[model samples]
Every structure is written in structure tokens, then in C-alpha cells.
Target: MTAADLPEIKILIDATELFPSSMLGEMVQQFLSGNEAKEIWLVLTNPQSVGVAYVAPEKLTDGTFNLLLIAVHPKQQGKGSGTQLIAEVENRLKELGARILLVETSGLEGFELTRRFYLKNGYELEGRIRDFYQDGDDKVIFRKVLT
Candidate 1:
């Protein structure tokens, strides 16, 4: 996505309850400015964005990338938008010779569906960090190997 789409993307982020980022605009701008470390992908329904995926290559690692965030607007959830976004991201990464795509998500009760989404998309549960996010909330990690 380009800088012009930042506003709509931010709205998707907000609506999805993803972690708020005060620097999203600047971050996207830097990516547009040749920050190869970051890439933002969007799924739009004509004028409005319905899904987004923000990813970054893992530093000092060959063919390793992290899916920092992926979300589908509530209204767009339950549709194939998310799976399509995942397929797009994976296809693009495979073209880049990426071997592994990692995703991290909260392990809270509220995030059960989110975790399941990743699993359903061919990402295997790799590990989990106890009390990583807080006293009780954990950080669950999943991995998808792309040949």
C-alpha cells in the first residue's frame, strides 16, 4: 500500500482492535521511502480497505520473515478475505525466497479465534512464552515453512 492509503488502513487497524501504533503513517512512509525491512499489504473492496497485513523480514536471518500484523475488518470477517490475504502474503514471500513465515499473537481467551485462524491457514504452533504479555496473558508463536 502507498502513503495515500494510510488513513483507511489505520481505520482497519483501529476497528480490528490491533495494537495502536502512533507511528504507522511515518512507518508506511519510510517503507515507501525504500525501507526494505517493512512491507504492508492490503485487501480493498473498491474504495474501502477490508484487510491488511504488515510484515517485516527478520534481521540477520536468511529467508525468515515475521507477520507482524494481519487483520480483517469485522464486517469482512468470516469471508475469505483473510485467507486470501494470507495466500497473497505467502505467495509474495515465496517469490522472495523466504523459507519461513512466523506469526505471533496473544494467547488470551479472547484471542482463541485469532490463534485458530493462523493454524487453519497452515501455520503450525511453534512455541509460547508464559506471562510474556502480562501476568497471565501469553505470547503464542506460530510458524509456516515456505519452500
Candidate 2:
């Protein structure tokens, strides 16, 4: 997504509960200096943005990327937008010669659907850190080798 799209995309982010809506501007601004594809960003524009994603190279690792955040508007949640986002991110990373993509999510009961989404998308259940987010909240990591 481009700088011009951030305002509208922020709505989607907020709707998806990905992060605090207040932080989007500060976060996206850091990646917006016009260097193309250094970070893989995408927004699904079905009339309006229904999804958004951000990916960055993992520090201290060669060709390893972190799918830092991805969210689809709640209204569009079951409409394949999320799958399309993942496919696009993978395709873009492959073109960039990336070797792997890692995604993390909370392992709370409320996020079981999210964990299943990753598995359905071919990500392996790689690791889990108990109480990483607080008591009874684990950090679940999923890995997809792009090769």
C-alpha cells in the first residue's frame, strides 16, 4: 500500500483489531521513503480496502521475512481476502528471493481461528512460547519455507 492509502487502510486495520489504530501512521511512515519493495505491503481494494499486510526482512537473517501484521476487514473476513493477501505476499517474496516467511499470533482461545488460518495456508506449527504475552497467553509461531 502507498502513503496515500494509509488513512483508509487504517480503518481496515482498526476494524480487524490488528493493532491500535493510533499507531498505524507512525508505523507506516517509517517504510514510506519511496524505495520499492524493501518491505512488501499490500492492500486489497475491493471498491475499498478490505485487507492489508506488512512484511519486513528479519534482522540478522538471510532471506528470512517476518509477516509482521496482516488483517482483513471483519466484513470481508470470510471472502478469501486473507488467503489472497498471503498468496500475494508469498509471490512477492519469492520474486525478491526470500527464503522463508514467519508469522506469529497469540495462542489464546480467542485466536484459535487465526492459528488454524496459518495451518490452512501451509505454515508449519513451528514453536510456541508459553506465557509470552502474559499469564495464559502464549506466543505461537508459524513458518513457511519459500525456497
Candidate 3:
């Protein structure tokens, strides 16, 4: 998506804390313009919504896509929405020549549900960064081979 898509993308961020959620538009624009990745893939809820997953090209050493953000409206959870979104991403990334996917989640003590969700979705825990959240929470890294 382009920087122009941020306004709509912010609505999706408001449904989750993938980002500050307050500056969804600005955040998306910045991500889109940055050189951190070769490309960014955004999947929306529909023609008028912003619930999405931002998949960026991996960093210098990792030859994969980084799942930067994935937020679904709470009201839409547990209905296979997350799975569908991920499936779309998997297909798109495959087309882009990606061979693996990497994701990281904050290990906030109370965010067990989020951690479990990733595990249930076939992401295997690869490592952890101690106290990575600045709130005494760790950061858990998960990976899934796409090829």
C-alpha cells in the first residue's frame, strides 16, 4: 500500500496495539517509505476497512518476510479471520519469491492469548529477547517456513 492508504489503515490499528494505533496513517506512511524492506504487503478487511497485516521484506541477513503487524477487530476474532489473512499473505509472499516468514510478539506477562494464537497458527518459537518491551516483558520470535 502507499502512504495514501494510511488513513484507512489506521482504522485497523485502532482495533489492536500493533502500533501506537493513534497515528495509524502516519505510521503506515513511514513504514511504506522506509528502506528497511524491499516491499510491504498490506491486507485489508474490505473496501472500506483497515484491519490488516503488514508483511515487509526481511532485514539484511534474513531472506524472508517480516510480519510486522497483524490486527483484526475484536468483534471479528475467533471466526477464522486471522487464518484467512495469513493465508492471503502466504500466497502473496510466495509469489514475491519469499521462502520463509518471521514474526515477533511482545512477551507481556498478560498477553498469553496472543502468544498462544501465534503458536496455534503453526509459528514455532525460535528465540526470545529478554526484557524487550521496555515494560519488563520479553520479545518472542516465531518463524514458519513458506517454501
Where is model 2 more than 4 Å wrong at Cα?
35-37
Displacement of the residue 92 alpha carbon in candidate 3, Å: 1.0
lDDT tens digits by residue: candidate 3, 65-129: 88887877776777788878887887888877788898898888677887888888898999999
Best by lDDT: 2
lDDT of 2 by residue, 4-35 (tens): 88888988877877778889877777578665
TM value for model 2: 0.95
Residue 22 CA displacement from its true place in model 3, Å = 4.4
For each candidate in turn, the TM-score is: 0.92, 0.95, 0.80
The digit string of per-residue lDDT tens for model 1 on 89-119 reads: 9988998889999999889999999998998
Off by over 4 Å in 3: 2-5, 30-37, 46-50
Clashes within 3 Å, all models in order: 0, 0, 0
lDDT of 1 at 105: 89
> Candidate 1 or 3, higher TM-score?
1
How high is the CA lDDT of each candidate model?
0.84, 0.90, 0.75
Best by TM-score: 2
